[model samples]
Target: MSVFLAIVLLSLNVGRSGGAIKPVVTFTPNWGNILYLDDVTLTCDVPSTAPEEPRTYHWYKDKRPIPGDQQTLHIIESLGRDSGDYQCQTIGGDISDPVFLNVTERYVLLQRLPSLIYEGDPLTLRCHHHRFCKAINPKFYKDDQEIKPSGSDSTFHIPNITRSQSGRYKCTKQIQPCYTPNVQELSDESFISVKELFSPPEIKVPPSRVIEGDEMTVRCDTRLDPLRGGTKLHFAFYKDGWTVRGYDVSDTYRVPSSQLEDSGKYTCEVRTRSDTVRKRSDGLYIQIYELFSSPQIKVPPSRVIEGGEMMVRCDTRRDPLRGGTELHFAFYRDGRTVRGYDVSDTYRVPSSQLEDSGKYTCAVRMTSDTVRKMSDGIYIQIYELFSPLKIKVTPSRVIERDEMTVRCDTRLDPLRGGTELHFAFYRDGRTVRGYDVSDTYRVPSSQLENSGNYTCEVRTRSDTVRKRSDGLYIQIYELFSPPEIKVTPSRVIKGGEMTVRCDTRLDPLRGGTVLHFAFYRDGRTVRGYDVSDTYRVPSSQPEDSGNYTCEVRMRSDSVRKMSDELYIQIHELFSPPEIKVTPSRVIEGDEMTVRCDTRLDPLRGGTELHFAFCRDGRTVRGYNVSDTYRVPSSQLEDSGNYTCEVRTASDTVRKMSDGLYIQIHDYKMQNIIRLGISGFVLSAAVCFIYFHNKW
Candidate 1:
């Protein structure tokens, strides 16, 4: 018994040892020190101490079981919500240590505005802590290079500023471990620009001369950065350093109307808004002159023969700058400078003609650094002794449809007697025709298709003279009259057919000839068959109701006589049906019916007929009828008056009644009543008279 108990205890011990599972969990994270707004994963794994079924795992936060029983924990975006301590626990009895997370913010702040310092002026830059209650000692940096360590209040001060002191400056807080050591929390960079103080503004172009009424401009510029409050600067112009009549402006001043009093030394000065700096330009001297005088012109022997040489001179008396002044002489014809001379005194005009007769002027110029002044112009004219030759044409005006002749004649030259001469005729500059005649030539009217100014030239042994005659205008007349047209069946039915004819008297010039005639309606030409004298327009439509005309054109070519318009109108036709009453004889108080029939196209639908009952000349009753009409009559009034009319697309017809009368017995009751009333009235009057006498 003891030996058997020992065996069972060994088996039990073995079973207990085998069923005890060794649970293992491995926590693997995607990252260490999880950052804000990042995803993190915590994976847990269990080592094999085999159980009969799969073991379940659960995740937890700060030792509390998560909602789902999952071994792997997934954190989507790590915010403050997911920033607390995180841990995972398994159903098989394993747990993980808590993992802590942290969040931080980064930003920048401004402590002061950018400033400008004049030369030798002190400057300062101030920066404050970016985050509250943080142990941060700000460090100063210039152009990203460490300059000095700053105290609790990050302020950088410069004792004196020069042009080299201008640069970008910033301050940053120092950070320690957990982040990079000395991590900069930068402050907004400030700019410091240095300027020079109270340098007199430079003046330019002194001793400048300008004529009165001419524009004069002077510029004053300084080397200062305008972007650093440039508009706040004030500029003043002074003549010899005393304030002149002008307002303060930037760099330049322009005096459009310069007077003689404006001649002086000018200077410009610029002042800054802070009163710490000012600049002035170099001095400029300007001289103003009076209005320039008009130039004088001189002509030698103003009177000269045509084709003879002449001399013309132009000179300017006033010279702005003395010493060998070179004057420019320009010759003009009709106000246009044709030739110019670069001479000190005079210019020669060669070979003068009537075309060379016009005003001439000359101008003198002085060479100066400040201004270039020109003297006023001088006027001169060249005269010549010659008269224009005269020309005439015979039969200047020509009438249409008549024969014409043209002759070219010039002034007779007596010096050259009976000499062989050459004559040429021109119409529009180009020679039309030429002939070797003594003096004149004749042109036929058939050759004068165009009319314009005609010119003729007669050549002698020594010279050739040409003259232009007055313009001759030629007129053409309209000799033919428009053709006349006529048509048949002037009126047309709305839907009925009709025909038309267009006729005209043929012209004698085109007699016995086959002429093509066309018909026109509206603005469009209508199609029709043509004859020598007339055209037939057939099968006309309603649209053909308008003015129609005929054209008598030559059949060989379309260009021929066209006729005037003829008016025509088409009318709508209405046809009524015929109605007849049945039974030649009728008695009183009987039913009678009339039938209406029309011989019109079936397509012309919805035609109405009017029926009336007339006695003698008066109508008793009237009504409209479609195909058939019925009437119940018993009296004589209904028997006498009865007529029916039918209307259709082309005609209207009225049917007369057979004039039947109904006979009836006459009654005497009405006459008996009238006689009895008259007898009673007489008896009453006799009785009244007797009673009155007895009383």
Candidate 2:
């Protein structure tokens, strides 16, 4: 019975677990506060017991059936207007509990912008609004016209706005309702006026007569109401519709040194935080008549005869005449005022004089009280005739060897104009020289000796005037002749000293006068010395062996002349002391000999005799009695050359002969006997010749 009961209970539990209905669902909130207009779903948990066919869903508000019967109910948008209690009911399941939904609105809030504005200024407008539990879009309106739609917080900014931007503004709220319609609300209007602040000041320039490069003042003054609220003001000046000066200042502006360009319609403009205004007074045209242009004068007949009439005109043109203008004209001659005239046009001068023959000018000046205007000067010249005279020679008589000077002088009208007198010198009916000098002439010395039958001639524009002077003769005296250069020991010795002397010859016709002497070498002056007649060069080196010349110049006015060059040769005696020997090697105790000779001039005769000997540097042993020297036996000490010397009181000559070798051998009877007999025979021959010559 227990087994059977267990099987039966297990079967019943299996049957109950096999097929059973359960509920599954998901919910989404669409509306605020009450969660109305939310989405909901209902599903079956058990697969076997779930409905196999289509099923319908019923929407409910607080467990009551809603008007729409559908599985899902959609709300486009949720708002406060659509807030309510909601539920859902399934066809095969129990109804759900009610859900409370609440709606909220969002809006932007705006505030009033600042009121006053100036031209070229920036401004900002704000539009703000609020909605209960909803997000609202804010929009701005100006003068009942929509300006801009701002999201959330509404703000509109304008940069560089003008007065036209001023208007009445308001903020509007936009509402979007869920499952309903949209709504809009407008706030109270805000007043915004861009008020123009101050008008530009009027400018006045005192003493309107403006001149270039003249200092003047321009003042700006006007009536305007002071601005408020930390406003900065600036003033600007305009001329000819263009801005001339602009600066930030409290009010007034002053300008000095109003240039010619500033002489135009001037207006002042004022700028403030709120307004920019300009005001212009009646234009006062400034006439700037500066004395910039120099005066010019015209002259007729620049050159005129000394007793003729001349006319000069001076005039000036300028503007702005305060009173009747009067000009004072003045005429000048050679930097001096010759005459003056007060006239507007030409001034006539009659009967011009010699004093008026120079450069004559006329100047015109306006009255001092009025604007200063001066006319340029006109230069005039008067003509006059004159001739150069008083021709003479300076230091009239010229000496033959002396210098001379000549000069010509003449008188001329100091004011001669257009007439240039030229001085020409004539010699023997021929023009030798000429000068443009109108007053004086000078001739250098020595050149005046060529003057013969001299005359002074002056050339003028019309005619030539000449004046002759008595013929003058020039006498010239010879000063001194050039010095002659003579050398001592004319035949020079090579590497020997020499001396040179210079002698000057003076003319007895002219008194004996000490003259200056100068020595020269190779056509170049070496030194100058003042002496009576002669000069000497004491010592000379090899380089001094050249053609030497001397010059003598008289202390009087005489030209220096150079003498002919003199050449001298210096020779030296032959110096011979070198001596050399050949076959220098010799055996001891052997007979050897040497010869002595030298390259001395044979004309010197035996005085050039040379002797040679063999010795160490200390002493001589063997010497050459004649041209050839012999020695019986040579020793090792005799290995040196045999030296020969020929010398005189002034010179010496020396030479060395070839070395002589000598060797000694062991004594033999035959050698000894032959040597002995040869020596005996040589001795006997020498004695026989000596004795025979004596007999």
Candidate 3:
């Protein structure tokens, strides 16, 4: 037997309208009761579905009207008279349950919020005392174990509360009063129980019985606390104790086509993203019934003879409940399709031959093609009129422009030597020559693509006693290798020449073949096909640097190859210049200096550079060898945006610095101070002489 703890629920007095959801009332500083002069705040919490605008709130105490109409009721100085049952109501919404508040004048007390506590909620334990008594070095304990001790803070707080924190809690502290000795005091123990944030998840499915070939969906359902509606939750689905769907925000798992093997015990799980609280639903058994049974192949002939007609049928039984459903059938021989799906279950072979002698099977499927099954195979042997054929290739190692020939070889029965036979040639399962009296296939000029697995078929003029030859492999070598891209002077600098070449080697035997080349940069065509194999940039700039590739192709484009990309980076001659001031802070009457800073590549060490200074976009000093500009006497008008420019001797690589603001201060204050000091020195000297003479 198990005993459950009871939660103190707030009883409702009035029924809510269908359009309204009940609101909740909560408080801050979570102390159930506090001493006189302590602060407490009460709030009205509504569901997220509420309109996103300000609303009017009505308050009541112990079934009586209160003075506040706002969402929150704040009490700065709590008094004994303020203790009562608090309730709130919002306009167009239901009235909230009532919460009790107790105010006492006790010397010391440990209190928690009077509202319900749920997992993931924050908990605060306050050790309160009378206003006149000062609490010092308060200590908190849970189940006789010291959790917090020797602290000046009057409260112990847990940011995220868990169910494991449930226990009896108390606080002890030293209290000191004016003109009285300090005394130790202990608070009454209060039990705390953290309720679940959400109920356990349960699996849900369609009410109808599940059947094979039908679509099915399973859902994991759980109810979360209304106050924590914004909390994130994850759901997962499982079958036969194995995971079917990993955790995701979606709570549903759908099966597009349910099968008999899908029938098993299924369960679903739900958890918060943090895995702090997890729950699994109870197992649910699901049964899927088949719509039809497996099919069987029926052959009429006990022994198949050459040139004789034969027929094969696929048989299957549908569920009695689905008697009106239509099914399709197909037939196969030696794992090769002989007949495609059709409403008729029978497959007819106009004339049985030795080539048709092999394992045979059949299949049945519904019109929707969702439910399908195959039948066991059966073997049928046909009397042969000729030995199996074999294909022989001439010049097994062939190159481009080489003449190739394939011949079908077979031996006919001596008694049937006069029978007329037709031959057909196939390459890679595609017909290359139709049935005719010829037994050889000839290619005047063989290329790389002409090489493949070749086979030949032989049959009598009436189309019976057919036989096929084994595959023969033919090889043809390429006329040229793939092209490659090469860059001239790979490491290029800005304002330098660059060239890209497409290179390839042609076979000595095919040296007379003509080839054209094209150039591309960053996948865009820069030059069309031409006899030249190189692309040149006389004066390459930074923009010319990119991924370059080239293509080589024959006159008819029958053979084309693109070279691998080559990345080219252009190095700058020098970095951009920056303006710097000698004294970051400038004032009137002070000499100010500005310098242009830039760095040139070591390779260009002897390059000459010139600098110029500007104020407000207008050049103040012409370009010169010196990088610095000096102002002998600064004035307030010097305060403006200043910039500098650096350029090469040829003025080809020019760069400018961003603007810098310089401000100058007034010089009148310094002059006045200097005059006043001189006047005071003269007056003091005259007064000293007059006093000495009088004495």
Top candidate by lDDT: 3
In candidate 1, position 16 carries an lDDT of: 27
By summed lDDT, which 10 consecutive residues of candidate 3 come out lowest? 1-10
Q: For residues 77-140, could you state the per-residue lDDT of candidate 1 as single tens digits?
A: 5565665556555554545445454322233332332123466455555554323234367777
What TM-score does prediction 3 earn? Answer: 0.48
Tens digit of per-residue lDDT, candidate 2, span 1-695? 22212222222211122343322222232112222232323221222345676666667655567565565566544556655566665565555434455443434434432122444445555553332325466777889898886676556777656567777877776654444466656454556666554444667766666654456666666544333333455667667777777755745444444344556776666665334443354444456555334456666675565545767665455445533445566666666765655554566777554555555455655555233344444445555544325556545545444445445555555565445555666667677676565444444444324645666566543333334445444344445545677776666544345666676555675565667777778877677656634444443344566778877776662567678988765332334444433345445666665545444433333453435455444335433335555557765555543455443333332334444333333445447788999999999999999999999
Q: Residue 88 in candidate 1 has what lDDT?
A: 55
Per residue, candidate 3 scores C-alpha lDDT tens digits across 540-635 of: 678888888899988877677788898888777677788899688887978999998888877776788899999999998989989999998888
In lDDT terms, how accurate is model 3? 0.82
* Pairs in steric clash, model 3: none
How much lDDT does candidate 2 score?
A: 0.52
Better of 1 and 3 by lDDT: 3
TM-scores of all predicted structures: 0.24, 0.33, 0.48
